[model samples]
Target chain A: MKVKFLCIIALSAILFACNTPVTESEKNGSEQSRKSESEDSTHVPLATEKKVELKREGIFMFYVGAFEAKKMDTKKNPMLENKINIALDSISGDVIYGHSVVAGNIRPFQGTFNLKDGMYTVVAKEPGDNKYDGVFTFTLSPDNGTLNGVWTSNDKKLAVSERSYDLKKTEFKYDPSLELDGTYSEVYNSYNAKTEQHEQITDDAGKLNASQVELTSKDVENMYRRDLEIMRNAIYARHGYSFKNREMRYFFDTQVAWYIPVSTDVTAELTDLEKKNIELIKRYEKHAESYYDVYGR
Target chain B: MMLGLSTLKNKRKYSLLVLLSVYTYFLWLMIRITLQYFPAHDDVAFLSIKQDYVGMWHYKLAFFIHVFSAIFVLLAGYTQFSESLRKKNPKMHRRLGWFYVIVTLFFAGPSGLIIGIYANGGTSSQIAFCLLAFLWMLFTLMAVIQAMRRQMSSHRAWMIRSFALALSAITLRAWKYILVALFHPKPMDVYQIVAWLGWTLNLVVAEIIIIKKIRS
Candidate 1:
């Protein structure tokens, strides 16, 4: 009985050793599929053990310059430009898994796509739990480079009920040297009921390259709270991080031209320099006196 | 003559009431600001960014010492400066004066120097804070020494100077609000400017009062 048990353990250990390479090969196969989608080549299956060819299975980003309203409305303006990332988990069948990031809200969407007359017609719907959830009806070019769509709200009573989006395919690449340019003045949103004035920040706020350079206290000490916030978020923006903070979303979605909201989590993508800068910037942000009403010095 | 004397006394009483009211209101504001550190979390309020120093036991000790003791000295100003208090209750006046002097020289002043060395707005603000702490101790020391020597007028002038620096705690925040409202400069830029302006402006006014009112 002891000899049989020892033999069984040895066989299982050998099997586990063989199983490790299969998982590693599966990861390489997924990575190859991602490359194949961009390279427009036949998906190369890493191992004969796995037979399925990779289809459209990676996240695709589209830049929607403006969500133009169909009808003119005085109360609500739905014409803001933004980016949406559609994660196509599977495309071989009618079912699709994806999510769209808009103004910091990530809403999961399920849809269908069909090719006819060299144009792919697509229909997708967000979950009905949220009032803002809507139907996306769009057409993709033959090459899947551009997407044109119209969104109709689930709730008709919303100020702007229908809007159209003409989306240009955007590629996201992480670059550490990118900097936020120009000056912007906007009314900061806070719980303080008294502050209604627009706080203006200087171009000096944009000069520091937080990702590439190790920031010192002198470099960021003079920065306003808003500037520090922008500086820190710019690091994440470079990695295609989709911001959940409303202020960051508004700033990146509206002002930053290079920003593409591709993923909700970008922790693994952060370099050591970037991670350090984030910690430093966050410390300054926490101590920033200007973020709130001028109370604590 | 009696009517004139009574009216003058009434006028002094009224002015003291006004001063106390204003002081009480500012004290209330300071108290509210201080309450942010009640339970003493490592990263709260001003200490949030000072994570570098929060780990050090001495820095933490010094910070709380300065924060907790400075307010008592500020309160002591009311009794120490009041002529009626001094004349009517000399013993109470002396006690409060000693309280203010001792706290400033030993606790508030030294701790202020320690924290000021690590002040946030860089070396310029650090210099401003360190100088302010040193001057605070110096003035308080001189005030006590003058009182011991029975040089009442000299002691009064030094006390005025000491209190002006002490009041920087309040004026610095006030300047922060004003500068921020007028020009939305960077937070630390405002801090560096107000580091000097907070006390210097008060000292300037104090000097004017000393040369014109007290010296005359």
Candidate 2:
């Protein structure tokens, strides 16, 4: 009995240690598939019958679920349900994707569209600056983009499964009878989670409370950096692009960066508004050094 | 008695009582999460695990099976260690022991093994949990087999080890809190270290109880 128990223990240990799931990529050799998808194959927009200028920017909201069609009761299941916020550009038809402002706190997406033969295929990928990873493709309806598409990524390692989700989009701003009574502003606390730094919160008398922790110069510097990042992202979002500190890509550029993945369905061109936003961002960057110096960071 | 410690049994009972209370409290927490938090459909604060199980019915069912059976076994499994209860009420002891072993092997151990693979902090953490699951099942099996063959001393020792490992679910969280309060280690580092530390520490204590104390 003792020997039998010992042998069982040995077998069980071997079973567990040996069968710990390694990534399928290692087994299937993803190097080859990666090679095929590795190329920066930029798809140019094929000119169709005629161009139509969009006059109204619509606040688009999308509901996403993972590969479930009919019975999508997420409250009783182990699937991801995401609420995505985006807006379509009034002039260029480009989509501006915003962070979730809630859980998952997804990063900004710069999306472009291709309207060819009355079939609209839109592709959006997260900018390098964003902490999230994924590429999405949407098949847009003709009248306005009522979105239905698939969001896919193979990078996630959970269950060695890809995060291939289906999305449904509704244009929130296009409702004719919509009205707002009051301007709403969400007041944020002095301590920012993103930067792990605290800023001074002054009372009505403009006095910092005694209870507030004094910020070091380094804290001030970090806050400034986060502010700069938000402003920089705003600039990139204007042109339907994301900015990276190390190697950023602008839409107006003639060539694409090697790191930008191959997006087959997207087509975009630089707009006048993008050019203006770029100019403003550039001016701020040029003078921002002095501003930081004034803050003692 | 073997180690000339007259108070050994009392000491063991006291320590076991403390651990038993702690274990009961943690199980209550799990039950609270299932009944109150999950049903209310609350927003995920730090982790999205609630979302994961809530969004899929099969996963939710599996989670409940693992949780309910594991906690039930922990509650019932400890009573077999009482010397007075075993001597006086042998039938109740045998019945409860059978129920604990059968439910654990059939429901708790398998379900735990399934979920242990999906443990967070990446592959190393997953491996740690998987080994834990394996050992949990192995020790329980050894205990049952030893009982069947009338090796009472060996059976009790194995049971102690099995319950020690099973108590890891409680100790894992305890170690994480202790580590964070003391050192404030990185989240991933804390998770990985605590995952290993909980079961290893329990097993060490179990060995001490068995070798120096439980010989009869």
* Every model: iRMSD: 25.3, 19.3
Candidate number achieving the greatest TM-score relative to the actual structure: 1
Model 1 docking tier (incorrect/acceptable/medium/high): incorrect
How do the residues A167-267 of candidate 2 rate in per-residue lDDT, one tens digit apiece? 34432221212211112211222456865755421121111111122322212221222232233333333222322211122211112111111121111
- What TM-score does structure 2 among the candidates reach? 0.41
Across B1-216, the per-residue lDDT of candidate 2 in tens digits comes to 576575886797578667655544565544333332233333322113234344566555556677657766755534677676678679978998998888778888887777677665568777888888889889999999999999998998998999888878677767777775566444456767877897999999999999975553
The most accurate candidate by lDDT is: 1
The regions of model 1 sitting more than 4 angstroms off are A1-66, A72-79, A86-100, A105-117, A123-130, A182-197, A214-216, A244-246, A265-276, A289-292, B1-9, B212-216
Docking class of 2: incorrect
DockQ of each model vs. true complex: 0.14, 0.01
Clashing pairs in 2: A76-B54, A77-B54, A77-B55, A77-B56, A78-B52, A78-B55, A78-B56
- For each candidate, what is the lDDT? 0.70, 0.47
Those runs of model 2 whose alpha carbons end farther than 4 Å from true positions after fitting are A1-297, B1-24, B34-47, B50-61
**TM-score (0 to 1) of chain B for each candidate:** 0.92, 0.80
Residues A9-85, model 1: lDDT tens digits? 43453344334332111111111101112111112112221112213322233434445567435466443444565
